[model samples]
Target: MTTFVLFGGTGDLAKRKIIPALYSAFVNGRLDANFSFIGVAREALDDADFRQRVLASVSASIEGSSANGGGSTPATLQAFLALTSYCKIDAREAADFEPLKQRIDTSGANAALFYLATGPDLFIPVVQQLAAHELVGDNARVVLEKPLGRDAQSAREINAALRTYLKEKQIYRIDHYLGKEMVQNLLVLRFANSFLEPLWNRKWIQDVQISISEQVGVESRGDFYDHTGALRDMVQNHLLQLLSIVAMEPPVNANPDAIRDEKVKVLRGLHKFTPEEVSKHTVRGQYRAGAIDGKPVISYQAEPGVPAASRTETFVAIRAEIDNWRWAGVPFFLRTGKRMASRSAEITINFKPIPYSIFGTNQRNLRSNRLVISLQPEESVELFLKTKEPGEGIRLSDVALNLDFAEASTSRRVESYERLLLDAMHGDLTLFVRDDELGAAWDWIDPILSAWQGDSEGLKSYISGSWGPAAASYLLAQCGSAWGEEYVED
Candidate 1:
C-alpha cells in the first residue's frame, strides 16, 4: 500500500489541479485498491468536510470534462472518496505533523508520497517538520510544485535544504509541461523516426520558435505574478524545459538519467547573455489595459493586489542560442506572455529555404518547408511543403501533412497532472526536473534578470489580446524568421 499525503491540500492548486488529477487517475484505474489520500493544510477541515470538498472538486472536474466528452460513475467516486481524509497542520508547529504521521502509519502502508503544493517559502519548513517526525522514510518521495525560487541563489538554498532531510533521488521537481502528450512524443518523434533525424540540424533548420501564449491575465494571482513575472514564472522552468527537449541530443539510452544527462548538457550549452546583448536579443513587456475577445480587461498594475507602480514584466521574448555542434548559430525564439492573442503552446521548426528556386525568378513568394508541433488547443504535427498548383505554370502553394493525435489514437489521453502524479507514485523520474537541471536553468536566467534591473527602458508595454510587444516580432525579424502563423497572410 502507498499513502499519498497532500500538503496545502485545500489551497487553490489542490482544488483546481491536484485533487482533480488524483480522482481522474483513480477513475481511470491507474491507482490500485490499496492507495489512500490525506489532505494536509492549515484549513480547519475534518474528514467529512474534506470529503465534501473533494466531492465538489471531482464533480466540477467531471463537469468540465463533459464538455470534451468524458465522465465518471457515482460508485467509483464514492469509493475513492472513502479513502480520503483531511488533517490540519501548521507547518511551523512540529506537533502538527504528529497527526499526519499517525494517519499514514495507521494505514499500514510501506511507502508514502508527499506532495508540497504550497508556496516555496514553506517548502523547507514543511520538509523539516516531516523529517523531524520520522515521516520521510527511504521509500517516501516528495513532489515539489514550481516557481522553485525567484532566482538561482534562492533556488539553491531551497534545494540544499531539501537534501538535508531527503536524498537527491527522493525529490521530484515537476514541470507539468514535460508531462504533456506531445512533449513525451517528442522523444519518439526524434529517435523513432529516420526521416527527420537527417534534417534535425543547424544546417537544415533556420530558426526554432517556441511560444506559450495565455488568453487570460493573472486572475487571482496578482500578488504572486507581480513578484514572479513571466521570466521566472514561465521562462525559467516551462520554456527552458521545452527548449532543452527540442535541442537536446539523443540520449545514450531511454533511462531517466540518460535523458536528463543530455538535457543538462543542452542547458549548460545555452549562450550566456551579456548586458549589451540583452537589449538586442531579449524583449520584456507588461500588458496595458486592452480588450481580449471583445471584453475589456485591466492592466497588470490595475489588477487587484498588484502594486500601482510595479515594473514587473508580464511578457518575455528572447532569441536564445545553444552553443553546441548540433545547434550552433540557429536561434531559438522563446516567448511566453499573459493576456495574449489566444491560448496556445507550440514549437515551429522553420527549415532553411532552397538555395536557388528552379520554378522561376517569380517564385519569391514560395515559403520554405517547416515542421510545426502544436501542444495545446489541439495536439498535432504538421509538415508544410511547397507544391505546384494544379493546372498552373509551376505555381507553388503550401500544403500541410497533419497528424492529429486525438484522431489517430483510440486510447484515453492522460492529462498532464494525472500522468505526472501516476509517474511520481510509481517512482518514474524521467519526466520530472532534476535539481541540477533547475540550477542550470536559473544560472542562464539570472543574467537576464540582472540586465533588466539596470535597464528600465527595455520593458515595453503591450496591449491585451496581442501576440506581445512589437519588439518581440522585431527580435525574430532581425534574424530573418518569424513566429508561427504570423508569417502567413490571412
Candidate 2:
C-alpha cells in the first residue's frame, strides 16, 4: 500500500488542481489499488466532510473538462473516498503533529508521499515537525510546490533549511509547467529529432518567444498577487523553466540528474541583466478598466486587496539572452500577464529569413519559418512553412502544418499535477526541479527584482482584454519582431 498525505487539503489550490488531478489519476487507473490519501489541515472537518469536499472539487473540475474526462461511477467514487481520511492539526504547533504521526504509523501503507499544498512559510515547520516526529524516512518522500521564495537569497535559505531535514532526493520541487504535456515532449522534440537539433541554435533561429497569458484577473488571490505581481509569480518560475527546456543542450542520457544538469547550465547561462539592461530590455504593465467579451473589469490598482497607488505590475515582457555559445546573440523573449486578450501558454521559435526569395508581390508579407508550440487553448505544435500559392506563378503564402496533440491522441492527455504527483510517489525526479536549478533561476531573476524595486517608472496602464501595454510591443519592435498575435501565419 502507498499513502499520500496532503497538507492544506481543503484550500483553493487543493480544490482546483491537486484533488482533480488525483481523481483523474484514480479514474484512469493510474494509482495503485492499495493507494491511500490523508488530508491534513486545521479545519475541524472529519473524513466525511473532507471526502465530500474532494468529491465536489473532482465533480466540478471534470464538468469543466467534459471533452476530456469525468469522475468514475458512484461505486468507484465511493471506493476512492474510502481510501481518504482527514486529520486536524495546527501546523504551527509542533505537538499537534502527534495525531498525524499516529495516523501515519497506523496506516497500512508501505510508503508515503507528503504533498505540502500549504503556504511556503509553513514548509519548514511542516517538514521539521514531520522529521521531529520521525514520521518521514527513507521510504517517504515530499513534494513542495512553487513560489518557493521571493528572491535568490531567501530561496537559498529555504533550500538550506529543507536540506537539514531531508535529502535532495527525498524532496521534489514541483513545477506544474514542467509536467505540461508539450513541455514534457519538448525534450523529445529536440533530442529525439535529428533534423531539429542542428537548426535549434542561433545559426538558423532568429529569436524565441515564450508567452503565458491569462484572461482572468486575480479575483481570489488578490492579496497574494498584489505582493507577488507578475515577475515573481510567473516569470521567475514558469517562464524561466520553459526557457530552460527551450534552450538547454542535449543531455547525455535520460537520467534525472543528467537532464537537470543540462537545464541548470541553461539557467546559469542566462545573461544577467544590468539596471540599464533591465530598463531597456524589460516591460511591465498594470491592467486598467476594460472589457473582456464586452464585460467591464476594474484596474489593477482598483482591484480588491491592492493599494490605491500600487506599482505592482500585472504584466511583464522581457528580452532574455543566454551567455553560452549555442545561443549567443539570440534573444529569448519571455512574457506573461493577467487580464489579457485570451488564455494561452505557448513557445514560438522564429527562424531566420530566407537568404534569397524569388517569389513576388502577394509574398511581400511572406515571412520566415516559425514553429508555434501551444501549451494551452489547445496542445498543438504548428510549423509554418512558406509554400507556393496554388494556381499561380510562383506566388507564395505561409501555411501551417499543425499537429494538435489532443486530436492525434486516442487516449486522454495527462493533467500536469496527475503526472507530477505520480512521479513523486514513484520517486521520479525527472519532471521536478532540482534544488540547485531553483537557485540559478532566482539568481538570474533577483537582479530584475532589485532593479524594479528601485525604479520609479511605476506601472504602465494597459486596458483589460488587450494583449498588454504598448511598451510590450515596443520591446519587441526594438528587436524588429512582434508578438505572435501581431504576426499571423496562415
Candidate 3:
C-alpha cells in the first residue's frame, strides 16, 4: 500500500490546502483504494478527534467552496476519513518517531510519501528523525514546500542534508504555481502549436511582463513576511519559475528532467545585476495606509508583528533580461506586491509594432499585437490583434481571441494543491523544482538581496490600494511598455 504522511498536519497549510486537495483527489477518483494517510503533528488528538477535524475541513473545503466543485458525497468522505489517522509527535523529540514508524509498519505500507508542510527550520529535524527510525526507505518519496531557505548558501545546506537521506529523484521540491493549469499549458501552448514557435524569439517579441499582485496585506503572516520581504517570498521562486517557463528553450523530451534542464539554463543565463544595475533596474516599495475595495487598510509598518520602523518591502518590481540567444534583447518585467489595486497573476508578452503602418499616424496610437495569459482571479489567454472597424472608412481597432480555460471546460478544474499532490503521489517530478534549479534561482536572487541591504534609499512607499510605487510604472515606462492593462490617462 502507498502511505501518505503529512508532517505538520495540524497546521494552517494542512487544514486549508493539503487536506482539501487530498479529499478532492479522492472524490475525483484520482486516488485508489490501497492508499492511506497519516497526519503527523504535536496536537493532542486521537483517531476520532482527528477524523472529526478532517470532516470539518472537508466540508468547508469541498462543500462550502464553489471553486472546489462541491463534489463530496457522504459515503466518499467517510471512506476518505477511514483511510486517515493521526499521530502525535514533536519534531524535536527523536523518540516520538519510533511509534510513528511502528504505526506505518503495522499498516503494511511498503511505499510511503512524506510531505514536510512545516516551517523551513523543522525540515531537517523532521527528516533526520524519520531517517533515524528507518522510516525513509528507498521507496519513500519526500515533498518540500518552498522558501526552502532565505538565500543560496542556506538553500545549499538544506539540500545537502536532504541528499544525505534521499536520492535526487526521490525528492520533490514543490512550487505550487507550477501546478496551475495555465502555467503548465505554457508547455503545450508553445510546443504543440507550430505557429507560435516561429514567433517565440527576440525578433518578434518586444517585452514580457509577469506580475503577481495581492489586494490583501499580510494578515496572520506579518512576522514571517516582515522578515522575508517580497524578494525572497515571491520573486526568488514563483516569479523566477514563471519567467523560466516563458523563456526556456524547447526541451529535448517531455520528461521531467528534460523540461527542467531547459529551465535551469534559463536561470543560469539570467544577467546578474551589479549594484549599479540593481539600483537602476529594481524597485522595492512598502505599502502606506490606503483603502482597498472601499475599506481602509493599515500600512505595512502598522501591521501587527511588523516593526514600527521596518524598511521591509511589501512590493518589488524588476526589469530582468535573459542572456540567451532567443531572449537576449527582450526585457522581462517581474512585479509582485501586497495590498495592491487587485489580486492577480498575469504574464503579458508584447510583440513589436509593424515597422511601417499604411493607415497613418492616428492608427499609430493603436497598441501592437500581444499575448496575455492570466493565471489568477481567472485563468484565460487573450491574443490581441489589430482588426478593421466594419462600417468605418479605414479605422483599425484591437480585438482579442480569448480562451477562458475555466469556461472552456465543462469539467471541474483541479486546484493547484490537488494537481501537485497527485503528481507527487505518482512520482511525476515535472511540476516540481529540481535541486540545481532551486540553487541557481537563489544564486541569482542573493546579489539583489545584498544590494538592497546596503542601499536604504532603495525602499520606496506606495498607498496600499495603488498598483505599486510610481517607480514600478517607471520601470516599464523606460522600455516604452505598460503593465497588462494600464493606460496613460489624459
Ranking the candidates on lDDT from highest down gives 1, 3, 2
Model 3 lDDT, full chain set: 0.91
Each prediction's whole-model lDDT (CA): 0.91, 0.89, 0.91
Error of 2 at 28 (Å): 1.7
Displacement of residue 481 (Cα, Å) in model 1 is 1.3
Q: How accurate is candidate 2 locally (lDDT)?
A: 0.89
lDDT of 1 by residue, 21-72 (tens): 9988888778867999999999888899999998988888877775212557
Which portions of model 2 miss their true places by more than 4 Å? 67-71, 360-362, 488-490
- Index of the highest-lDDT prediction: 1
The 10 consecutive residues of candidate 1 with the worst lDDT sum are: 63-72
Tens digits of lDDT, candidate 3, 106-125: 98887899999988888899
Q: Which has the better TM-score: candidate 1, or candidate 2?
A: 1
Model 1 steric clash pairs: none
Backbone clash total for model 1 is 0
Candidate 3 minimal-lDDT segment of 10 residues: 481-490
Write one digit per residue (lDDT tens) for candidate 2, span 278-370: 999999999999999889989888888888888889999999999999999999999999999999999999999978765544455766899
Superposing every Cα of model 3 onto the true structure, what RMSD results? 1.4
Off by over 4 Å in 3: 67-69, 488-490
Cα-based TM-score, every candidate: 0.98, 0.97, 0.97
